[model samples]
Target chain A: MNYPNKKKSFQKEVNKANLGMTLESDIDATNRYYLDSGIAVIHKKPTPIQVVNVSYPARNKAKITEAYYKTPSTTDYNGVFKGKYIDFDAKETNSTTSFPLKNIHPHQISHLTSVEKQNGIAFFIIHFKPYNEYYILPIHLLMPLWENQYKEKGRKSIPYAYFKDNLHQIHFSYQPRLDYLKVIQTVFNF
Target chain B: MNYPNKKKSFQKEVNKANLGMTLESDIDATNRYYLDSGIAVIHKKPTPIQVVNVSYPARNKAKITEAYYKTPSTTDYNGVFKGKYIDFDAKETNSTTSFPLKNIHPHQISHLTSVEKQNGIAFFIIHFKPYNEYYILPIHLLMPLWENQYKEKGRKSIPYAYFKDNLHQIHFSYQPRLDYLKVIQTVFNF
Candidate 1:
């Protein structure tokens, strides 16, 4: 019921998020609900990290004295849906005008490419926070822009206008808020 | 050229694996080679862990003072192979006669069943290390026995003889040493 800061403004309104959860956490909750109910099996894989040192304080207690987050070798989320393999990454951009290409790394692009070849569903869930908008932009729609970034080296981001015209926009709700899987149904028909 | 101990004997050969680097590390190496060569995309998911406390020693360094291993929600390895979604866990048993049922948990079996319903390739790579044997035994083969464990209160382990008779045996090679994909090719005919 209370956030640390008592300051009231649009910032405070943004902090509430209705049920007091971020878009990412909401997706996580939705996933938990899905898995619990036998609807689907999806999970955000643990971020791969390197542990340099650790000490055992007790038989079961572990104290990691040193550790570092490593560059992930694959996408953040993956699982099966409707008898189809689904893989995706979720991104949030503060910029309301465009989604920065830098947010999508080269390794991730290649990972999606590999998944595509394997007939797995590959896409990005881009959330524009300012407008409270989310879009399920498939790899097919993104690959050309990704390739052109290197070929022409002119534009390094996708304009909001482009997304407005071509994206598979997803609506939010009270429970299972993101409902990107609903968009998956529309996109993949699975 | 050097292992911690230089001792050579059948018993010592078995002791080398107790360091926790035999099957898992080899598979990790195999996956790395596969990714580098653009052969097939597969990865061993990092074990999920719970962090209780953390402190930053510097801008670039983190000190996790407390943490604990968490129950994983899914299998250790999963990825796409030849346009097919694949998922499996690798289990090693010291027992010579049978693989211990306790090596597997109830959640993993349920996870595999869900994957099967979704048309994903689900199986177990059971490595009988003492005998240096590996079998790509699918869920369909293990389920009846698993169910029987509850119904008849029979042996909790699947005998080595049963695996040898029905398992999809694979050979080791210099590169991608286990060559489990080759076994998959034979078993799935892909």
Candidate 2:
């Protein structure tokens, strides 16, 4: 199994507040577990990068010297589970009251909507950092709130109370770390 | 849509032989056409990269100073098609007589296998550069030959004759340069 170098990148900087086990890491571990256990074939897409320059320091060793992160057009994670396509993104917010809508790119929402239209399960896995809580909100549930935000009286963010009321909270586990698939099974029933 | 900068990278060096219109670029245009026409929502994944260092030259601008390309675990392209998961890789070979088996990575084969297990439509879009011909070979058709490569008496590569006989050649069009999905619909009968 030829893989890339083990060196970490600035991508992990966002999780510095979590000590070590951030929601992203937990989800990564869970996805790995899922892959190993034959439960599902999920994976986080590699971070999109726009390379400006590269140097060939040695033969077969191309090093990118200048690059910039690109906004991904699709969700961070996607895969097939029991003949169903699963697509989602994970976000963590420090606010205890609400999750700011700006965290999600408009492209992601449109991509998820397209996925849902094609009969795939699309969703967001949100982590309320202050409360140490995780919630899987399907795109179907999120659409109305998302549409409402553009209206005159709509809120720009989704309140934590709304998540607590409408979504099933995912709890931590040993093997998979975050048993999101379990929550998904109950929510999606497939 | 705020996209990344318009800087070309070493990634394009591989297609220098084509002068300009490589299979990749054609597929990119085709995918864009599919997106605009509201056809199947498929996309080629960004090149996987492993960043080692990043420097912030300005307040909000991050410049990646050191990075390396990673071997992709899955195929280059995947998305929802006709409410089904679609997965595939596009490869261009200069050879006219045969398509080298080594052109495919083991991880890609494994990933496609898993996709097929989950009932996703997994395939390979091969462009024989010398002949200006394209062929979409399903994962199932490729698997037996892949296994045979390990056997003592088996051939190392698949001859062009095999592809011509077994698969339908994808012709070029103006809107979607490579009409692969049409070939797929005809082949898979979906």
Candidate 3:
């Protein structure tokens, strides 16, 4: 599938925005809009920042250069919709067949496990490469794949056919490119 | 109280470890340790990355620069704790008496408000400068002060006395520098 062209144009649209929003930013804004409109209460988790050396450019301004990425200990996003705790990760894959397990870390899978154990609604919004097709895969389905991969019996990536059949399709709208709450509503009645 | 003069000693410690762990990294490690041990479920959120350009040093390696900070749309940390969703911000302040409201954006406060409304647990881990004393101030308490700050009679920071009396004090331990779950346990019995 020729996904690069469509993905590039989508990237261009995001870059052309005055705010220069990224895919994550757009999703966040859309989530906030959804929250404000009383559609849902969801939020992206903040990136962990480790400020090592801060140069004071001014009294009120500080510049940070020396920093390292910290391993996140929880899922990317979580909140409540109609009294149900919603949890999920927003991931974009360039592969047409499946998202590579490498895109997800063991810690994230564990976090999802914890969320599921707590009876919270957990899933992932995966964007297929070149084709802008987005699908919502439940955490339960992901865990077994992750386990099988770890055990050396599963493929490194989930086939696109599996995604098409098992996952719920999330429609992209002007307001929320990956408006996933609608799928959540269908799955959890929230 | 004046903080101990440990700059030279701490720098020596930093050099001896050969680990360029930032304060954020240390916090993340601590949270991970706690989670792995089943002590608590907490995570530092992923930073919002706006990757405008990516340089491929190697086919598998991509170095990102020329990116800007995207306005965060959610709280920094959140997870499940004994059937409740825990959410909060870990802020370091160099003030002695009070924490500045300016440290938190209006949108973040709104996010916390929404979390509180959903029956999830939300609070802030405020680190007092020099003293290193940390306190967990609930969102419910912070909201009113945040709102009243614009009434022409509002204080810029929450006084230490208010924190001491109302907020739960979190002790800095070796495992979890800002071990706040203990406070949560006391407050919510979880």
Candidate 4:
């Protein structure tokens, strides 16, 4: 665990070689590292799909012919870490100054709210593509902004400065690309 | 929460109306009840599928043309319950005298083992169809039986008497068809 702090300096050099990968892939790599090392058990839930038609091509082989993506009813990723239920969604924004609120579905907000009520750790891994910066925002901090946007007709997006000032930044690394759990260890003090 | 035990007497009458429903649908209904009543936040993960081709017939309406079901890498159900991470899979067997071990996948067993190591509640909801019986088997209890099958070349199935003697039976009710959480509260002492 002490190695988390020591891995910081090599982040930039390692991430430069992985510039072609998407945020989703980086997070997947990070989860794989966590799982393989026995540090945690995290996984990205497969995208939900609605199958309308299926054709049996041969014995014991069925192929789906018609289907559509379904909006997920829960967060993208969830698992157990340090004896706590961990839940979160990963999002990337093209805008340099703000992250659009629409990027987070309402169902996820409701689901995370329920998670928080049960004392599970709920959060977001946000990536600012233009700046190549990553931050972890706990559901508690996001709840106020989420409410204000709907109740008070506040800004539809969260300014980059808000995240910079209020949230914990996640450093990119060689093995676990995003290293959000390192931030979790510090933020949650686990 | 205190109402769990009180609802036991109404089981048979309510379940008779849902005689045609499968075990999966009953679990889904039970989870919905838990969620709506603010008791728990459990969910069954969507079936994983590998999509090969998609065509956009119109803007924002992509239709999948080819896909195949993928084997799941983890348990089917997981979420936060009473601040504890709960993970499990539901299974059914038509055999009258024994529950086949092959009904549970190797990946699911491995995933549940990891969940248990993290202090998460891990178990299975098993239904013996001919008897219309349901039992909750904790991962801790199942682990030895799982290992014995491979190491000692033991019996491939668990006898009906074993479940009736060792596991907690789940009563079927109107609101939550399979009241497995009630058994959890008693078994895990949450």
Off by over 4 Å in 4: A1-21, A151-153, B1-21, B151-153
Q: Which candidate is the best by TM-score?
A: 2
TM-score ranking from best candidate downward: 2, 4, 1, 3
Question: Could you give candidate 1's per-residue lDDT for residues B94-114 as a string of tens digits?
Answer: 889999888888888999998
In model 1 chain A, the worst 10-residue window by lDDT is A3-12
Tens-digit lDDT track of model 3 for A1-190? 7434655655665654533235577678878787878766787666564444544443333345344445576666777665567788877776777788888877778777777776778788787746778788888888778778766566788888898877788877787666787887797654
DockQ (Cα-based) per candidate? 0.46, 0.59, 0.25, 0.60
| Model 2, span B1-190: residue lDDT tens | 9653334434466556464357878998998888777787888888899999988766557789999999888888888877788889988788879999998899999999988887888899988888889999999999999999999998889999999998989998787799899999988887
Ranking by lDDT: 4, 2, 1, 3
- How would you encode candidate 4's per-residue C-alpha lDDT over B22-135 as one tens digit per residue? 888999999999999888899999989999998766555779999999999999899998788999998888789999998889999999988888888999988999988999
- Order of candidate numbers by DockQ, starting with the best: 4, 2, 1, 3
lDDT of 4 by residue, A1-190 (tens): 4443434544653574365348878988988888888888888898899999987665456699999999899998999987899999988877889999998899999999999898889999899988889999899999888888887658889999998888899988787788898899888777
TM-score of chain A of each: 0.86, 0.88, 0.80, 0.86
Pairs that collide, model 1:
none
Top-lDDT structure, candidate number? 4
Clashing pairs in 3: A3-A130, A46-B45, A47-B45, A47-B46, A47-B47, A97-A160
TM-score per candidate, chains pooled: 0.85, 0.89, 0.68, 0.87
Query: How accurate locally is residue B88 in candidate 4, as Cα lDDT from 0 to 100?
Result: 95
User: Per-residue error at B147 for model 3, in Å?
Assistant: 2.6
Better of 1 and 2 by DockQ: 2
